[model samples]
Target: EDQVTQSPEALRLQEGESSSLNCSYTVSGLRGLFWYRQDPGKGPEFLFTLYSAGEEKEKERLKATLTKKESFLHITAPKPEDSATYLCAVQAVRVQGAQKLVFGQGTRLTINP
Candidate 1:
């Protein structure tokens, strides 16, 4: 079965603290891995797309990396504004090539100033 699971359901960090969130997945054929930041009561905002192992992408304080079975979102020196639910989603290769995202339960991060 293809699925994604994220660890440490919630994290609380002081401003300027750093942490890493884990997204573990099991997929038949991984087409792509995606990361998003979602605020409460709002939709997700795209952060990065990772294809193939060892691929990494970054935006400001957030860095995303991919592996065969899992992906990681590393938060470096996060500020209060960087606090949000980090989402991990995966797209699987399909026969018709129509890709759909399977999203994991996001990790809620709070950066306290």
Candidate 2:
């Protein structure tokens, strides 16, 4: 079974604080791993897509790295506006030509000024 688990179900940080969130996953025939940020009452916004180990992507204050079994989202000097639920999802190799996405519960991050 394919599954994703994100650590530190919730986090609180002061403005300018830096931290890393973890996303661990187990899957068969991996295809790609994805990251997203979702604000309250809003849909998730795409962040990164990693296809293989050693792959990385960055945007603004966030950087995402992927490995065979897990991925990390590193935030540097986060601001209050960065507060949101960060999501991790994975797509396994197509089954009967159909692709499915498995998602983690997400890490809810709160940044305070």
Candidate 3:
């Protein structure tokens, strides 16, 4: 069974504080891992996609890294605008021509000034 787990269900940080969020997953025949940021009442915005261990991607104040069993989102000098729910998802090889995406519960991050 493929599964994803995010740690620290919720986090609070002062403006400019730096932190890292974790996403651990287990899947057979891995295809790709993805990252997203979702604001309140809005759909998730795509952040990055990782296909192999040691792969990484970055955008603005956020950087994502992937390993065999987990991924990390590192935020540097976060601002209030960065407050949102960060999501992690994985895609496994198709089973019966149907692709499935398994997502973690997400880490709700709050940045205060």
lDDT of each: 0.92, 0.96, 0.95
Stretches of candidate 2 off by over 4 Å are none
Alpha-carbon deviation at 77 in model 2, angstroms: 0.5
Task: For candidate 3, write residues 1-113 as lDDT tens digits.
Answer: 99999988999999999999999999997899999999999999999999999999999999999999999999999999999999999999876767778999999999999
Clash pairs detected, candidate 2 = none
RMSD in order of candidates: 0.9, 0.8, 1.0
TM-score to native of every candidate shown: 0.96, 0.97, 0.96
* TM-score, predicted candidate 2 vs. hidden true structure: 0.97
Model 3 spans with C-alpha error above 4 angstroms: none
Stretches > 4 Å off in candidate 1? none
Residue 42, candidate 2: alpha-carbon lDDT: 99
| lDDT ranking of the models | 2, 3, 1
